[model samples]
Target chain A: MFNQMQLDILKEIGNIGAGNASTALSQLLNKKIEMNVPMVRILSFDEMMELYGSADKKVASIFLQFSGDLTGNMFFVLSVEKASTFIQQLPGLDQCSFVLPPYSEMAISAFQELGNIVASSYLTALSEFLRLSIIPSVPAVSIDMFGAIITYGLIEISKVSDHAIVIDAEIKDPFSKDKNGFIKGHFLLLPDPDSFQKIFSSLGVNQ
Target chain B: MIENGKTIKVGIADMKIAKAPDKLRTAGLGSCVGIILYDLHKKTAGMAHIMLPDSTLARGKTIHMAKYADTAVETLIRKLEEVGVRKVTLRAKIAGGAQMFQTASKSEIMRIGPRNVEAVKKQLEKYRIPIIAEDTGGSNGRTIEFNPENGVLTIRTVNLGIKEI
Candidate 1:
């Protein structure tokens, strides 16, 4: 079960993970694609979908997934138009209109590769702190929240556990210019029921 | 067009179909569903590019009045009926429900694309609206055009099914 200190450890682990993710993105995008410190919250499915209303679901699901002592998931969503625009406008990226540009094989591969880097970075960060090797299951990428993507992820995670702590963050760099810089994200942890109760106790204690 | 209106009419999201100038209407949508019902003829055309099926479950902002396959379809039917579209003229043309999200979630979890499609079909049937045309189930999201001017529904997604449903 996770306590205040344990959650802090998890948060630090997430911080490192997302930091690594941003580094990979900067390199991949060939620009200073910066990411902000992630905001963390534990939520039910409905709350999660509500947040997406602000984004564009007509796009595909771009995110990363990590699991070990904890699970971290992130979404880099874009509306179909925005995704096409981003990919087309993705400065350093090539403009290969292979059938559908954003939904092409290259796009999914690139997205998965990004997910791997970001997810691995979190595992790497968590390992550095948790001192335990954390290898995530293969990243599960999807089109949008529309299909079974969102529900299934929640179902799968909730089946194995009780709660997921989601971290939301915008991917932007004030220092440089990456207009295509997106809102990438990562998760701090998704603990079991025991862990959730444990964190609940800690939250009360901290307050 | 409403200039920073509260209406969020993104693809695969909320879609409202009305004639004249209503605050809630998006002319361009694809892969998402296109709905039409006559509130007077009682006719209404509503479409939601729902990427998911059930709102009772999921993570990170899953519940929008316009994003669920079940809610949007049923809501449109009821609203049109309330305005007076008879159940017969209420025959529908639905499109979109593309597999926009193709990832481990498809292989590992339920296929929401098909789920939403089937859910809409079932819901529409419950109202006895024979689906006259349906272009759905694919990998691309959709753009739907509903002319409240004539109640004509035109849906355009990508690849797979590319006809007016």
Candidate 2:
């Protein structure tokens, strides 16, 4: 349970991280990208799954593990369609045949780099803001059921606590005005239970 | 594949019991075990989606009993008994305890899937419930559907296709 002020502080952290990541993404795609307000929620395992609506939905995700003073997990997730679209538009990938479902080697590496850029941008922002050394592990790419991938991420924190602190930022493609047509992606961070204390203290909070 | 029957969904850290002509389903299980208890005599089934190996690892008082292997096994046994299924007539089948990401396998937490399988097996043995079949311990997520009518558990995965246990 976080106080209003604490929640605001976390939101501010998300804003800074998401802003930096969005800028990097715009450069990557050479297209203007937009981001919505970052939201921080304390959710149970069930609620965490609910955030994605349906667990069976296919998704392409890049996973990263955080090490150092503040341990956590982070990922950048996009729908399979959006991931394909983003990859096909890459400088030299237009001629590559678009495969279905499971991604090809070329696609995997491409997504991994995208994930690295986005996740590192956020981690770098956190490191600067909190003044703590936070190193993220190499990115691992997976294209599978959304629920399965997310469940994999939650296992670490679920061992220590029933609820997880999720900082979620929704990234949108500004060029597409159609709600459904726009490529929607999620940048998520889940700090371990012990790390929360360190994070709050680093932020000058006494929770 | 959608089965033609009343299907009850068991979400993450949840459990459910279904009678014959109905099915119990749980989706997106990764590093989490889906334990199914079947009663041959009464044609009843109970499923629990367990997340952790032990209840002691829980941070707070036992709030979600179904989320742990130890408590969930005991809870499912009780649920089956209440539905007129005798302990002697019960058999178990489990699936899903997958290491979804390979790079994270070096971390102990990433291997929780296999640990969960071991814990569930231990609990089943304690209750004298023999495991009939299982499809677990891979690096992939699974969606399972348990039908009490024929006492079949169908396990579906992204890369491995579908198999019935």
Candidate 3:
């Protein structure tokens, strides 16, 4: 139900936010990180689950709920392998294992802190761009199934409709030697349905 | 988990029916509840993956019957009846509704998993459908499958592996 101009605005917002997040990641890991152009799409809940792979795909997700002028959910998701790799980069966490539960408290905290730094950077950029006061909740880390984790963000939207508007941004390691170029993670921004109006109005776009 | 029979897949906010030699399944249920209404004697089952507790919460122009607990149970029963399964013979097995994230905020949405489980139970009670088994209220996602042939509900979780309830 959004026009091309509105979609473009959302894409631009993602671009700026993801760029800042990538910068934060680079600083945290002390390596060059690159982000792709963010994609904005309207998808059904089922289709949204398939964005990763399948609903049952295991993922390490850092979730935060933001409130203020614009309310929504933000998820920083990484593949289990990538998450372990990132976790190992933290000092004293070289032996941390994310493959099973009973995960060490140190590893969980390290991952949460990493998520907080990166996600806050994204939120800070968005708030500054829109001139809105957006306060994020404490980052919660859940290494679980993608469908299960993401549906928590969709509860508000699912009340009104089965579809959701998502702003998807990808961050990757530029120097990775993997044949497919390792994708570091994904930032999924899901604004509540009502929040869309606030965002578009803030950008001077009439829906 | 069904090895021999074709499985009827139910998507989020959707429902479907399966008869003997076939199975009903739904994947990735986090805060959502997967309800299975089936008849042991008839060897038929219907599954709904409901996202919300009440249909009254819907603000959209049209309601998706399978998206809410109240409406989904009624719709599932009706569908089962249409397939020649008696309402009196039906039983229920439910799963999912895990608080996927732990947040200190008192926002109702954060506790939706418990709310969903409660609502589904209320609806089933209203219909007088006895709940035979359930695997709910946890912090993990579940993939569930119901085999109508022997009336078994198989639940798979990331941490606990798989169990039949």
Candidate 4:
């Protein structure tokens, strides 16, 4: 449970990190990118699943494990279509074979590179702002059902608490919108239940 | 009304039971197991979407009974018994426990899908419930629907399409 001021501060922190990530992505693709203000929600696990819509939707997700001063899981989720668009942007990567099962080596590497850049950019900004040392592991790319991938990220939290603190940032491609009316993806940060107090206390919010 | 054959949905860390002309379902089982119990004679069914292996792992003040394999199996059986379904007639079916990311295998949490499956099976053994069928342990997500009338469990996955066990 966070006070109004603490919630506001968290939102602001998320926004700052998202801004840096968007900048990195825009430069990589040479396109205009729009970043939404980060939305922070403390939701029950079931509610979070409902908010995500059906768990069966296919997605391309990059997972990164965080350690150091603050420990948690981070994920960057993109629709398969959005991922294909990124692959199309990169020259001459369309013709590679046998990387991960069902995914070409080129696609997997592209996603991993993209994930690393975006996640590291976000972390760098947050670590500087919060003055905490945060180190992110190498990104792992996967294409799977949205629910399964997210469940993997949330298991550590679900063991101890029914509710999860979800910090979400939406990054959109201003020039190219998909049939879904949005060519956007999500950057999610899920802190373990025990880590929430450490984060807030380190930021000097004791209440 | 049981006339419409309505479907009862069990969310993650939740449980439910229903009778004939009705079904129990759960979606997006990554590292979680969907355990179903059905009695052919009564046409009654129960389901729990379990997220963790044990209740002892809980650190919160409130214990979510349906979230752990150890408690979920017990809670579901009691609910079915309350509805006049005999525990001796109950049989089990399970699905969904996937390691979604391959590179994450090095960490303990990444193996939770397999662990959940093992825990669920162990709990069923403790209750003397015979497991009729199971579709578990892979790197994929699954949505499962259980029909008590025919005692059929349908598992849907993005990669493997659909299969009935």
Off by over 4 Å in 3: A175-183, B1-3
Write model 2 residue lDDT over B42-161, tens digit each, in one string. Answer: 779999999989988877654578989999999999988888888888999999888777774487777888999999999999999999999888777788999998889998877667
Q: What tens-digit string does per-residue lDDT give for candidate 4 at B86-135?
A: 88999999998777777734778878888899999999999999999999
Best by lDDT: 3
- What tens digits encode model 3's per-residue C-alpha lDDT throughout B1-165? 546879888999999999978899999999999999999888899999999999999989999999999999999999999999999999999999999887687788789999999999999999899999999998989999999988899999887799999
What local distance difference test score does each model get?
0.50, 0.84, 0.90, 0.84
Per-residue C-alpha lDDT of model 1 across residues B1-165, encoded as one tens digit per residue: 443323324333445555333223332232335454443243344444443455564444334555556777777766665656555676666665555444554343335456667877887777787777676776554445554434555544343343443
TM-score of every model?
A: 0.60, 0.92, 0.96, 0.94
Residue pairs in collision within model 4: none
Docking class of 3: high
- Poorest lDDT segment (10 consecutive residues) of candidate 4 chain A: A93-102
lDDT of 2 by residue, A1-207 (tens): 888988888888888888899999889899988999999988877788767666766678888889999998897888776777677768776544222644467877887888899889989998899988899888887777778888767877876677788898988885553355432788888887788778789988988
Interface RMSD of each: 8.1, 1.8, 1.1, 2.4
RMSD values for the candidates in order, in angstroms, are 7.2, 2.7, 1.9, 2.6
Model 2 docking category? medium
Q: Order the candidates by TM-score, highest first — what do you get? A: 3, 4, 2, 1
Model number with the top DockQ? 3
Off by over 4 Å in 1: A1-14, A23-34, A40-61, A64-72, A76-111, A123-137, A140-166, A171-207, B1-36, B46-75, B104-110, B143-145, B154-165
Worst 10 residues of 3 chain B by lDDT: B1-10
